[model samples]
Target: MFHTDCPAREVVDHVTSRWGVWVLISLRSNDLRFYELRESIRGISEKMLAQTLRALVQDGLVWRQVEPTTPPQVTYGLTEFGREVGESLAELFDRITQRLSPRDAG
Candidate 1:
């Protein structure tokens, strides 16, 4: 937890939350439809994913686009700022995974 109360701390909490990290990492590569995001990140409930996306959008870290088609297609992707942060998060995620892998327990 961050010791100081600052805007940056709130943003950090949002990005580093368990669900937030997965959402950001999933969108880092390409824009994804709602169902696609659900498929990409397993075990996340529809409610939670929606909430996560909404928070990211509010933070300007994610972009939500709605196509005015017959059914109104909705897609989510990383914004310019999001891409920067996503890339950094991706790297940190990778490092965390590698470091915590069973092979490293020796």
Candidate 2:
């Protein structure tokens, strides 16, 4: 799967990117508005968040909904496929955290 043009590689890159993983994990539990998502993922700049969301949406891993209103309320959430991927990522993240804790490391 290491071939330069492998499609899985692109998917993996998107899912495992520095911000992508965090985004997926954050959206796994609930859909969030742009600002809500940005706030939840601390330290992520507005630009980065937008870019990440765009990629996820294009990949069919996320759904972007625009509510009709004066200001156009926009929300982001994981697709069914995204939920599955996010679930696995969440489990992996938890395991990593557990293993790295001082109590576990000792």
User: Best by lDDT, which number?
Assistant: 2
TM values, all candidates: 0.85, 0.91
Candidate 1 lDDT over 7-75, as tens digits, reads 778778789887999999999889999999999999999999999999899999999999999998889
Candidate 2 residue 37 Cα shift, in angstroms, is 0.4
lDDT of every model, 2 decimals: 0.91, 0.94
Off by over 4 Å in 1: 1-5, 102-106
TM-score of 1: 0.85
- Superposed model 2: Cα runs more than 4 Å off: 102-106
| RMSD to true structure for each model, in Å | 3.0, 2.4
Sliding window of 10 residues with minimal summed lDDT for model 1? 97-106
Q: Candidate 2 residues 5-68, lDDT tens each?
A: 9988888899999899999999999999999999999999999999999989999899999999
- The lDDT, on a scale of 0 to 1, for candidate 1 is 0.91
